[model samples]
Target: MAEEEKTDRIEKRRRQSPKGEERRAEILAAALRRFAEDGYQNAAIGDIARDVGLSLPGLLHHFPTKVDLLLAILAKQDIDSADFIGHFRSDLRSLLKGMVDIFRRNAGMIEVVRAFAILNAESLMKDHPAKTWFLNRTARMQNDIAVTFERAIAEGSIDGGVDAMAMAAELIAMMDGLQMLWLRQPDRFDMVGGLEAYVNRLLTSLGLEH
Candidate 1:
């Protein structure tokens, strides 16, 4: 009887572990929806708790504060981005193509994209908790792209005379602008196609194969 009880207790813990994770995921989803529909400052934590059918305290158990929830959501997005861009290829063509594919994938995740767009704008303010996160992300992405461009230049795949950092900045700017435009009028915009065209032009200008 003692051994059986111990086994049962262990089984219960294993089941509860996944349940905890599921509840956390549900809370994050609800929080994401709220943050996307309303700006971060405007989103109420109690409403998010209600969205997941959890009491305020219950929601707090998973995420200690609204900022905690916001940061977790951003961290999850970073993970998702890494997953989307699996196995980074050092080659410029492959890297550029992967970015276009990421944009294509983003088209389907409207909520995630919307939240990102809204929060990115909001985080520009001095007091926003996510300000550093957005800044770091932008710098990191540009640096990654610049490094890839340098690699391509070294391989003679692109002209060494080209300004890698300048090109990276331009690429990121174009991507961010396209995302904003697509969010405004998704029906009228061809986000994926527009990026593809830009990339093709870039490749041609660099004297690289399309």
Candidate 2:
């Protein structure tokens, strides 16, 4: 009888543990929807909790604070983005093409995109919590693009005289600029097409295959 009771208790715990994880996932999903729709600062934690049928402390039990939830969302995005970028890591042209494809896909999620845009602009403030994150993201992107350029140059795929680091910075600037434009006039502006054209021109200028 003692062994049976222990086995039943263990089974109950196993079942309850998954319920806890499921509740956490539910909170994250609701938080993401709220964040994507309203941006980070404007998204109310109380609202998110209410949307998920939980009270303030209940939501807090899972995510501590709004910043914690935002960080988790960003971390998840980074993981997904890493996977997306991994598919075409072979060459600069391939990576650019892959990026354009990603832009096209992301266009459907305008609210989420807008949320990122707002956070990016707001995080430029000196003391913003996300400032360091944005800065690090920019640096990492620049480095990756520079590495791709260097690889192309080494393989005789591009003009050797061109500065990889400078070109990488320029490319990042163009990408950011185009995204802003797309957000303003999404229907009128063709973000993916614009990127494709710009990349083709860049390759042409570098004497590289597009």
Candidate 3:
């Protein structure tokens, strides 16, 4: 009887495991909706569970807390960078192209951008998880852009005197600003054209007669 009980428990655990992941994703989806529809402070976990057809316990099983869910959603942006390389295939052009593709693909995740910025603006606190994660993530991306800038300079694709680190920071800042602006006016911003235009300006500044 003990062996049978153990076997039953194993089967039940297996059944619950997949359900746990699915339930967690559902919880996150609903949580994002609630956070978007009603400010994050106003959105409750129970309502998220109800929207996703999961019990509060099930949601908890997937995300230990609300912050965990929020972080997961934010991390989703990095996870969605699959087509990023295609944008910069023949130098920085590929990277720029990837930005256009990514912005288009991640338009929904743009909501996460607004939520984070809003929360961050509410407090200038430094040790918060959202702020830390976003800072680290953007820093990493900037470093990558700096590396790209360095390589382009070596290939004579861009100006050698331009500080890669500074350029990277400026580039990322421009992109982030564009993203927020685009969120507000998708029809007006033209992300693809804007990025291409920025690259052209950089090339022209580098004496490349673009």
Among the numbered candidates, top lDDT falls to 1
| Residue-level lDDT tens digits of model 3 in 54-86 | 788877877878778877877674576533553
Q: After TM-score superposition, what is the CA distance of residue 90 in candidate 1 from its true location, in Å? A: 1.7
Ranked by TM-score, top first: 1, 2, 3
Q: Considering only N, C-alpha and C atoms within 3 Å, which residue pairs clash in candidate 1? A: none
TM-score of each: 0.92, 0.87, 0.78
Q: Which stretches of candidate 2 lie over 4 Å from their true place?
A: 1-6, 16-19
Model 2, position 141: C-alpha lDDT score: 79
Off by over 4 Å in 3: 39-42, 55-58, 82-90, 108-127, 207-210
Candidate 3 lDDT score relative to the true structure: 0.70
Q: Between prediction 2 and prediction 3, which has the larger lDDT?
A: 2
- Residue-level lDDT of model 2, residues 56-115, one tens digit each, is 998998899899988877787788776665677688788877778878887888766777
lDDT, candidate 1, 1-98, per-residue tens = 79999999999999999999999999999998998899899999999999999999988989999999999998988887764433455678888888
- Candidate-wise lDDT, in order: 0.89, 0.83, 0.70
Order by lDDT, highest first: 1, 2, 3
Where model 1 places Cα greater than 4 Å from the true spot, the runs are 1-10, 83-86
Please identify which of the two predictions, 1 or 2, would achieve the higher lDDT against the true structure.
1
